[model samples]
Target: MSIQSFKFSLQTLRKEGGISQLSYGIRVFIALCGAMALSWGINQIDMVIPLFLGIIASALAETEDGWQGRVRALLITLVLFIITAFGVRLLMPYPWVFGISIALVAFCLSMCGALGRRYGVMAQATLILAVYTMIGLNQATHEMPIWYEPVLLSFGALWYGILSVIWAALFAHVTLRQALTSLYIEIGLYLKLKSKFFPLPTRGAVDSLRLDLAQQHGQVVVALNRVREILVSRIDSNPTNPRLGRYIRFYFIAQGIHERASSSHYNYSDLAETFFHSDILFRLQRQLSEAGTSCRKIGEAIHGGHAIDLRDSEETVAGVLRSIDYLEREAEPTQWRLFRSLRQLTDNVIALQQELDKARQLEDISLSDASQQIPQPRVTFRSILSQIADQLTPKSQVFRHAVRMSLALSCGYAIIQNMNLSVGYWVMLTTLFVCLPTFGSTRKRLYERIAGTVIGLVAAWALITLFPVEVIQLVIAVTAGVVFFLSRNNRYVLATAAITLMVVCCFNQVSDGYDVIWPRLIDTLIGSIISWLAVFFILPDWSHRQLPMTFAEGLRRSADYLRELMRFYQEDNVSEQVYRHSRRRAYNADALLTSTLVSMQQEPGHFRRDTELWQRLVIRSHTLFNYIAAFSAHRGTLIEQPSNQLLADAGNYIVESLQEVAQCLEQKQLVTDSSAEFERLRNTLEDCPSDDDERHYFVQSQLQSLLGQLEEIRRLTLELQVQVHGEHIKDVK
Candidate 1:
């Protein structure tokens, strides 16, 4: 490639997270090379294995944080490494003492996850380092002092930590930029998925599409959370930086766009049935799809550090406006209710376009809003201890997982001692990597571990036979290490294969690599079986057990969101922070329920017998959330009209019904039906006069839609309750 083109390609890749992955790989390569060079220079080549293992552990412990945070994390990691390593050394002679000590250490470390993601990762890495220390002890010679391996391992971790901090300092904004880029891309995909509803597909297709949209929404929420963390870190570290302020404004813009895009004005099926013959639905679909494309283009610009040109987006908005004008002029008065919804959808699109335009010229924006400050959690020692203490129960998933991991590791160690395998630590290592909090994840990892090991062993044999030179093998090992880091999150099988190949190559440096292959495979199988058994039998966190609480949470958040919207309508001045906070919590809760259902699907069939009912509940709950979003989208001052009282009554009824349903689900009691009350509200809504006020009319339509959605939701919740608790509910006025 030409130099200019190559540079452009690199910039694009960086924006799309490719270069970020490459940067991670490079860091690992650099750390490994430094350790190899230093060990060979000092003629202490025996130390390279421990150093390499420490480097890997440190890398695993790393989280996305600013330089300051990284420094803090690094200190904690180093301290934990020292304690774990030396503790292993002191207890190594007594097998029983060592096994019980490691089990206790495992539970304590696993419980550290209650502190936060950062501590959880560090704890996991520390546990793995303990296992590595065991492996190193097996290879120790009498000439090596007891403190030798622990000190060198700590230094190896320090070496990688230094590199990470330097990288964070130099590229402070890179992670944030990547995160924002991903957020916009996910939002764009969500909009496109929403566009599919306009085609008026079959019921099955629509339900499937709704599920897909929910999954995509989850991704958007995850991206937003990541961006929130990075922005919070950077802003806290340097509050006065203009660049960070601009990024904060960009984040708020993305939030606005997501809220508008996620809003549903009316039922898609009903809209399609009413306007199937009209080109207006098609026009709206085209506009939404184009808006999605614009979002993606804007994301690309952000990634590439290029100025955005939104002339195309402007044209798309104009086309949508023209279509709306045409529809308004030609539609019959009988379809005016649905027509109003169409107009609202068009307005939402225009607003989304405006947000995109703001993002385009974000350089000129200033942070004027007081609510732009992202809240940071206070991390006092007492608070940390409190968080950990809260998780110290059998009901806590983290607690259960900790107990399971401790027992599994102890069992694996016993197997290792009894069998006297050459590299029994590999079995423990496999258990660590394979065991997760959920049955589905653990099962999936078990299969991938076995398959990847077989592939890696076969590939390693072929490579060693073809290229027997030690230097070539070393180069291959480094490359494999880089690949392993690059693909670890998205492609577990490939990562497993890459790491397996690297292990073989590393072992070949000091011994016959072929001898390690069979033992590696055998240890993996043994470990996989142990992890599988542990997760299945020991406090298995089945998703079915949590679905009721999850469903209730979703319902309660939806009601809270509606309550906020009602307050916004009733009060003169509501805080944007409060409204946005409620909206985000509602969306997050909906996303969580959807994800939980997905996890349940991956579990055994008997555990998910109510899957269909749960699916319907999710659809109705999200639909209710969408109706509230629509009301939020069109929030405006309504002059004191007769309809205002009706609106208030209808809104109060919907919120109460939602809360009641949530209460019933949580308590596993029968849901009380309010269909008669709902019908009376619907009749009152239909009888209310519009008084030429479009805003009032819009509010009435949204309330009407919400009432219907709540009725369906209540019915589904009742059916689900019956399925879950075998209770029959009766209608109550």
Candidate 2:
């Protein structure tokens, strides 16, 4: 990884002391202290029951929900945890019965993530509950009745659940602001990464920058989604909520700024060739870098709740504009088109700065004046259930993973039971944690887990040998638990190591820890091997099988956005609600494709036989979305609505062509070139009245530019189809 990438990864892991981090840390500390106090107060440190409950509750409390939702969800999970704990004990005497039952439960719980993020969290918590219960069974003593442990576990879970709700009630706004701050941080990083793509610094740098850009863009999309989810939930519950209205508007401004900031004006390679030695190109690069720095400053200010200096970015924009003017005059006649492109790029940067200014001023606006509803998908119980049903199919990736996990875990359980290893549950536990959705991820996790485990074991051994103090060991265990919670998402290897140390520490609280090390390592190896074998042999669904459908879905959504734009243009009374919804869907689809393509890259090389082609298709689809966004922005700015007959007709034709492209991709049909209709649309643009209204002329010019972009989309899609279908069709135009 580059230094910048490493820094980005580190920042993501540490969370940089935002309000969210503070809240999370507080909650974790509360859980720890509460659990430890109760355990000591009751004088039952043998079971370490409080520790289990506290850890489970703290881990599962990562829900972006309101107080009511968090409480309700936590209660539901508690019930499930109790049931699993008792049920596992009841079936422990019958190894075969227990194995099969556990396998089925694992399958169902793992598949729950297919529903949505909330359900995904529930699924993971349930899985952890199951593992915790099984481990308890392995350590079960004849002194305690079966119900005793289950009931005690439920108390721990309930206590943590109550604490979570209290935290939510007290710091809901802090959580929301923290989420928004994260979105801004990612946007800043994305902008900074994008700045590196300019001036085509070098061939080597270009590829690295592009990869970083793609990664950062994906992160930005994920952050934006979370922010939108939180805001939408608030607004949906109360549409006229003033605070939500202001925040939603601010989010929209950031979204708009990001759209413009990341939009591709011209090919970077083309820019390198056209203005290789031009001082203006370097000036533009510096301006972009400064803009990115300004974005980071704004993010920091937001995170810290401090005042922002808006004039700094404005001055940078002014300097960039002056540089553009100087270059425009210095350019020879041959460089006029290149100069125009450079000016347009600078204009986008300036627009982004203006949006940033507006965002900073958003606090002054009244809620009644801002858009009330946040753009998002309908998130209801019914919708989530329907999503679950839709994915419960043989073709679904989630289904395949669920089945794979069930089989792998069952095998691990059988091996452990038959061998009668001292810590047999560790084998199943390692298998459960190592197995991921994709084969590539599973393999990658295997390496990380093994390395992390060895390092953690060595660290634990050294600490115990050197200090040999119970209090210090307990503190180390608690610290490991805290770090595990904070670092799991961005630093999985570190989390694994910390969690391993935590488990060892907890074990030491009850029994001898001296003999646990070698067994843990051996069991981990067995589990990792089982997981790999199962994923590779059992109904493995490679990403190659799903890429076409994802590509088609992206194209279909782009077409929908185009049709919405046409409606907005023709009606001349654009409903912000409808336009925003369509745009959101399009952007979501693009993000989905980008994420899938990145996953596809991680799959086995043989499965990615046409990796280059798939990448081009994704790049083309992204470019298509950018053009559609530009069209939307340009159309929104027109003072006098241009005659929409030609534009509407053109939009309809383009939509139809895009739909055909999607169908061709999905059905493996030959792609027919749609250049003729695009040309006709261009020809019809001449009919737009070139009167004194400069805005009208600007709209005309934008439409012309949009058409050219559409033509590029058509060409790229046809090329992709030809590559996939292995057949080329003669051009009709």
Candidate 3:
């Protein structure tokens, strides 16, 4: 709620670069122009309303999905838009009835978002269409036929859909490349932050570096999620396209590189103490930094459509080799261990370089083998219905948001109806757009909504007064629409300003533009204030209240990921689908927790009493995740399998312990002593086979690390419990 919040938001927005933005801008520009030309110039449609609404749909339907998926989504959206518009127009003559209808429809439409992120976007777009239908109904004046509104709305939606499908068809590969490049760039940035930890001889660097890494890792997860969505959706639709085949292959390679590149295998303190006298630490830092640079260079090559240069990577490897040779005197155990870790790290970097080289030889390899790697799930009607039905509960955030939004919209609608304010649809529009799920988002939207409205109204007034030309104003309105869609996700304030201007300017075609400005500003302010009050007093789902459960979910998911890793190693035949799915779930869960932790920081101070404790929990959770990732990377390279019984016993103990922690967090109970499991795992590790002790030693190190991490997690969770519930746990040494 402070100015710093807005500053941080702006800083985050600044990071989105490259072709994703360009393509979106192009898509929006093309969609708007196409709609305007078809409506205004050729078809002579009714007042460009359908075209404007379709432009809105085009903006909302922006996804990293393939052309086929985009088409599917838009077609569904077109159907929903027609239905919602027609239904609203049919009921508008009855005030009380219309209000009730709005409530019910709003709730149902909002609930559609509960299905998932894709459904959420479509549902939100349909909700906006519903609002637009209401506005259309109010403007009908009883003279126009009911079909007039819905038909025009459907036309605009269809127009945008066609344009989007066409854009995706033409630039499908380009879009895929952009998404991949973005993913790689984000991973590169993550590697850079990770490299900061290599200079761990500096005092107090570990904690700060881990904190920074956690935040950056959260962003990398988001980028990976986007890349996965695009690649998976594409491969699912048609697993035959060579280009898509290549894209998926590269995606898997990037996934591997990300896994190995970002793991903090050796504790920073351990590395620092073991290499304090040697310049090997500095060389290791340089190697990591250069490797990060190479990753970024690969991204640049992808973006620029050129071959990736590996000279820097070669130099880095050579430097790391020379440094390793200089450390030949392995006089101590720690020194040998450090040397091995550095060698493994160098190998990971080399593997990344080799992956990049393979990506460069894209056209030389047949991707027939790659298609078998990804399994596509069959989408069915029964499954869709089941998914929708599953969300029909109070616990789902989407459901609660649905209820909350409907109530807020109803209140706004009632205010507009009672006050009889001119241009009152803006009030409802503002309220609908402002009521997001979390308070932080709602608060941010409110601030941006009010500020953007005032700024937009003033700017539009000046434009209208100066130009006073219908054609000029129309062009400006179209331009504003495109800008609105382009900036909607990142620069909300800019989006609001552009959209407000577009709406006011378009409305001016029916009313005086200058006279409408003040009403628009006043209505926006009123609507924003109402939204603020609603979010504050309504079923406010505070992040702090949700943090404990979220943190527990993070632990559970990380444990699930570890279980999957163990399964991959224990079984001779590994299922890529199972491993990848579990990995994605774990990363997504951690990312969700990380984002929530950030949101909680911006909440009221009273709700953030345990901020420090929450940070520690997040760091520990992330570090635990990194440890599991390391085990996953090393799993494939084991020369001999360790005792499955011992591994199974340790994995079960960890999983059960994680479940216990999750339950305690949710139930707000004090944690019980859990040292017996840890001790047992340690004892099992001690009784390893001496014949293949080297192989067993690797397993021992991994399991011991896992145990140590679990103990730390237990302590952190107990500390959090004490902070939240004032309960003291009995110490068991």
Candidate 4:
């Protein structure tokens, strides 16, 4: 490659986290190579297999933590590895004891998820190491010391841990940078998806777009949460660092940008219908599209470690202003309300642009009142105990998963013992990797594992035939391992294939590797079937089962958000912390509901009861959230007027209606008719004198829109109740 092209390629890799993945692959490669070299130098080739397995398990247990945290984790992991390995060796002689022990270990390890993600990962790796101990013991060439496998495994884990700590020290900020980059990119994509709604469309098309928007918003929420976690961890470690402070501010700015970008002031269909012949809608669409581009550019800047220019965003804002001005000058008095809504949208976009500018010069930006330090969860012993105690029930998904995994592993072990398969531990290992907490995820892994194993077996046969030399196979094994680490997260199929190939090659070094192909395929198939059956039959946590609670939570959070915004309207000021917290919680709940609905669709047909009705509820709930956000976006001082009590009453009625609907859904009761009260509020609004100011008009229009959305949501909730429960406490009007 030419020098300039090579430079561009490196930059692209760094931006997209290809470099980080490559670095991880390289680390694994080095660990594998070092282990092999040490084994060969000492003429202890039997130790190579266990050492390699240990290194892989250690890498799997790794999480994104700072160097100090990683060091601490590494020590704990080594202790766990030694204990697990030695325990397996102790129980290996008795089949019944081994089977029961393995099941109990599986249960305890799986329950570690209740502690947190980091502990869960370490627990899984430890379980895998337990199986590795069995494999290593079976592969023993001669009688050896009882301490051999455990000692070597601990050494291997410690070696990998040291490498990880060194790497973390060198590249501490890279992960944070990548996470922020992804956050902005997702936000930009969300904006682009939202822009599609501005054009006139049919009702079906609008609902479809809304579903897509909600799903995309979920992705943005995921990215935001990841960035927040990393920032919180880093800041807690070194609170005085200026650079870390700047990143925190940038995160706050992104949150502000997302809130403004996601705000909807009025119904898109109404706006499109009213401004169909005018360019105002088209102008707004272009402005949104360009603002999305600006967000992406900001992401690029963050990734590339450069300053961004706001010239394009400035121009986009100016064009939007001109469109609004033209619309105001040409529109008649009756069109003022729609025009005012359009103005609110324009102002939101302008505010978004200003946040983008803040991202450009983060060094000079002062922290806003809303930019408080993200709270970190307490890690005390009491808190940890409480967290785990809460999940130790049949209702908790984690508890169900732990029970399922233990039973499945025990069954696999029994099959292995009864069938007299020499390489039967592969079945248990396969079960360990393929089984997950959810059916959809477990099913997905099952398919990928089977497909990948078949492909890897075929490829391994060809490679064994073409390159018969042992050293060549060894090199291929290490390379396959590197490829596995690189693609593990995004390309599970490819990763699975690579790992399978690596296992075949490594086995060939110690024995007839060709003999492993058929057993590998058979074990994979058996393990996958077991996992699928386990998820389907054992405490199946179907996504549809979660619909009632998820939907209720979404409505409740939306109500809380609306209540907060009403407080803002009345008091003319609300604590930024409180307001933002409410906004975040509402968005998070909505995102969860959207994501749950998606998972529900992936479930079996029979389990998806009232699918269409559930979808409508999701769309309507999201619409209600949008109206509340619109009111929040236009927060300002209101003049005392005759309609003030009417407005307050309207807000109170809407909030109470939402809360009541949520309660009814949760309780499986009927929703009472609110049409009369809704109608009275609308009549009062019409009779109230119209304020000349556009803000007043915008607020009134938003209240009207919220009332309409709440009514629709109530109707959908009642229908859903009827469909799911067959009867209700009372009938609706």
The full ranking of all candidates by lDDT, starting with the best, is 1, 4, 3, 2
- Best candidate per TM-score, number? 1
Q: lDDT by residue for model 1 over 308-423, one digit each (tens)?
A: 77777688789888877977888876666688777877888899888888887776334334225566677798998899999999989899999999999999999999999998
Number of clashing residue pairs in every model? 0, 0, 0, 0
lDDT of 3 by residue, 1-733 (tens): 1223423432443435433665676667776777667666764544576568756764675555778888888877877887888877877778799899878988888887856677778888887877787776665434777688788777777766777788888877776777677677667777767766665736556666677788877887887777766766777666567767777777777788788765656456776788788776676676666666666666667767888776776686677677767677543666875555555555555665666566656662344677566666666888877877887777778777888888888998899889998777878888888888888898999999888888888888888778787778878988888777667777888989998788777767666667678878888888888888877777777888888889888888888888888775566787778888788888889888888988898888898768888887888888878878877776752445447577668777887888888988877777776788678778877675534444345445667677887898898888777766773543322
TM-score of each: 0.94, 0.88, 0.91, 0.94
lDDT, residue 121, candidate 1: 91
Worst 10 residues of 3 by lDDT: 1-10
- Residue range 425-487, candidate 2, lDDT tens digits: 788888877888778888999988898888878877777777667667767777777776676
Where in model 2 is the C-alpha error above 4 Å?
A: 1-22, 196-212, 234-246, 265-283, 321-347, 364-371, 375-384, 637-644, 674-733
Candidate 1: what lDDT?
0.82
User: For candidate 4, lDDT tens digit of each residue in 641-677?
Assistant: 7777778888888888888888887766788777898
Q: Residue 568 of candidate 4: its Cα lDDT?
A: 75
Indicate the residue-level lDDT of 270 in model 3: 74
lDDT of 4 at 480: 87
Question: What's the distance in Å from true for residue 664, model 2?
Answer: 0.6
RMSD of 3: 4.0
**In model 1, where do residues sit more than 4 Å from their true spots?**
1-19, 141-143, 364-371, 727-733
